[model samples]
Target: MAHVATWKKDMVSEIVKDITENPVVAVVDLHGIPAPQIQSMRADLREHAILKMTKNNLMLLALDEAAKQRPGIDKLKGSVHGQCAIMATDMNPFKLCKKLEATMTPAAIKAGQLAPKDIMVPKGPTPFGPGPMIGELQKIGLQAAIEAGKIAIKKDTTLVKAGEPVPPGVAAMLPKLNILPIIVGMDLRTVFEDGTVYKKEVLAIPDDYYKTMFATAAHDARALAIDISWTTKETIVPLVTKAFREAMGLSISAAIPTKENIKILLAKADNQMLAVASKSGYKSDAIAARLSSAAAAAASVKPAAEPHKKEEKKVEVKEEEQVSEEDAAAGLSALFG
Candidate 1:
């Protein structure tokens, strides 16, 4: 057996222990990032994660060894290229991604560096007074002019386009214009959990995305369950309400009376009787008086609609049934909201 250095063994063990303990493990790219910034990021993430940096070979060895117990952690070794570090956290992968993204700060672009996006100089007053500075700005392709006794850009100028190398002259003037184009910090490459690897694009989601998705899913699920007449603790109330509505409609059609639907049924019958009497030209004084009264009442106000009524009554003479919206909402919120 080959003799391994004690420090190397300890480093690998430390990494292995972190992987096994924390549910989230990630490879973060550290290319072109300063040591001071790395220290600051480590401090910021101290509460939510553990970040470790060492030789890439040692990291690979640790991942390989840990995979013996973890099964698929070695897959992360593919992301080990470039200056990188291993991070372990108990936080979920999505949240960890956001946390890491939050650590990024705007950095000034350097000469010969590739521009990440279009750098625009807005048309506005500048700090420079009328002097040779105007000539310097014009040299950098900015439409500079003297306005209100101060240097002002004539129009918004594109200092650098995406993927284009920033010229030395343009780079020097960006700081004077207060435009920091490059985002500098620890960048996440891939995350590992439960034997799965999540890439940067997959983890980059809005903060409320999952919450919204879960809520929408819950709503669709409840709607589907109701459509299928499937009964569950969540769907029982709607199902019961539907059943009661159907039962009430059936009873009215068959002229069966119940306390809950009796008023609406009576009103409907009265309207029907009046309609028949008016069409038949009946010669009864009581009928005439009643029809006049109904007309006056109709002109003044309309009765409540049957479809919108939610007032609950006993399906059985002695048993009371009710659905608490607050309770249902609470339960659904606990489950999917």
Candidate 2:
């Protein structure tokens, strides 16, 4: 049987040791990243994680060996493809993914490289002066115009849609325009934590989005617990407070006076009585006195100083003016005759 190479054995042993030591084991794609950038990333990540680059077979073997001790460590084997590396960290998988995402730096797009997101040429004056560059820009579907003796993008134009391969023309023109549309960094593929493996999709959550979801979930959980009257340490205080409020409200409504609601109940009863009395024309002494004073003032204002005396005239009637009934009847008979 052929023996394993000494270096391979050493690397496999080292990988096993790392997987055993670190709580998190991740698979990362290091394709297209330059060696200098890789070294820089290694240094940057040295504080929180350790990066290991080895042959895929060696990595698989190491994982298989390590899996004996750590139950799910070998699950990272499925993600081991295409210029991959292993990262061992004490940090949890989610935090490690976030840290890696933060280390990304914008890089110029390469020919035939797919855009990670919409690539737009901004509307502004470029360093390029008026020349054939305008035709070149126009050739790549960018609106270019000559302004102030310099070349400028007429408007923001989408040169490449996300998931679409960048054309050679657009790729060549981007560098001249100083447009960096590609973000280059170590891409984490998968992570093994304890006995579980989490994929990139699972770990790639925006920090704010995750926090908002978690907060909303926690609030909903609390509300549901209170709604169902579930007893828990978290719900206890609010539950007790709510119960006390409801009980107090019931006591007030029933007029069962307690220390907390006695004053409120009395004030409520007093207000009701005052309302009833007001509607029934009942008035206090002060109000009655004010009304009496107003009436006296009105009477005094009406000519009390002059003393109004109505003038009288006698009407006279003569007794001779009265006609007898017999004379009236004789006059009526003479007229008829």
Q: Candidate 2 has which clashing residue pairs, if any?
A: none
RMSD for each model, in Å, please?
A: 13.2, 21.1
- TM-score quality measure for candidate 2: 0.65
TM-score of every candidate: 0.69, 0.65
Candidate 2 per-residue lDDT over residues 131-157, each given as its tens digit: 888888889998889999999888989
Superpose all Cα atoms of candidate 2 onto the true structure and report the RMSD in Å to 1 decimal. Answer: 21.1
Worst 10 residues of 1 by lDDT: 313-322
In angstroms, the error of model 1 at 313 is: 39
Residue 270 lDDT (model 1): 50
Which ten residues in a row are the worst by lDDT in model 2?
A: 311-320
lDDT of 1 by residue, 263-315 (tens): 55555555555566667776566666755755665545655548877733211
lDDT of 1: 0.84
